[model samples]
Target: AFILGFALKDILANFFSGLVLLIDTPFSFGDVVALSDGSRAVIKKIGLRVTTMYLIDSHSEIYIPNANFQGENIINLSRPTSHYYYTISIPIKGDVDPARAISLMEKVVLAHPDTMGELEGKLEAIDNYYGHSGSGVKQKLKREVGRMRLLAEQDVTRMLLKIEMSLKQLSEF
Candidate 1:
């Protein structure tokens, strides 16, 4: 009995932790999270006793015990929206015009296909700069904007449906 208890203690703890995580759902599969160890990873799967994650920097899979995962300080980068703020610092010559440099940098970043910025302004800026260079940045930005809009509309529709169902139940009572 002592041997069995010793062997099953961790397993039972992990199993219960997994159950709590599944119910509370702080993060889900495919969500990006920053671990307490300062590593960023994407959650691949949640299992009975462990969670599988793909580390972004190492490009490798890591399995963490549910109990440990539950105890750690994990930042869910994908929650409240999948958008996270990033910052960069650049050094420029003192002789350069600061305003011009800042403007140029902003335009360059806004012109990137993957960046999130005002759609119309980005399209106009891309058109002015690329001017049919055949880089396809404008088209890609349009497609991405369309996809985001579609996802937002779907979420609104889902919420409306839930509200309608709740109202129906209230009326029945």
Candidate 2:
């Protein structure tokens, strides 16, 4: 019985931590959050066992265990209303419900050529990753491509940051 209790210690701790997370509501779905690992992604889903983060830059989803949250700090990038006013300016169909609107937006964004290309690159890299069946030249090219994509993403993110700063300045004035 003592052994069983010890064996279940971490699991119970994590489960309870998950409950605390739910109660606290520190972050919500679609809010971009940063983890201890320096990984920043949009919070997609918060489950009892795990929190899902969707990385738009890489077009990938990362599942983080709730226990990790208890051990580390999380930064919510979507907090405070006056500074960052993010809104979707798209027009929705008259008959579309909230769920349908969300689904449509997701589908439309994911279907964009640039998004699709990035997504494919991400998929290819993940699939071949360290387990490449091709020659060194092909592998080198693949990695180079991935690097280029990351650099491009970083540039875009930086540009967006600059734009936001400018907007903030304008709003202040």
Off by over 4 Å in 2: 81-173
The lDDT leader among the candidates is: 1
Please report the TM-score between candidate 1 and the true structure.
0.49
Error of 2 at 112 (Å): 24
* TM-score of structure candidate 2: 0.44
> What clash count goes with each model?
0, 0
Mind giving the per-residue lDDT tens digits that candidate 2 earns over 1-173?
A: 99999998878877877666765668765567777778789987777778888986788998877888866887887554445544668776788798977754555443322232355444444434422323466765555654554455555446556766776799998
lDDT of 1 by residue, 77-118 (tens): 766443566779888999999999888777766654445565
How many clashing residue pairs are found in candidate 1? 0
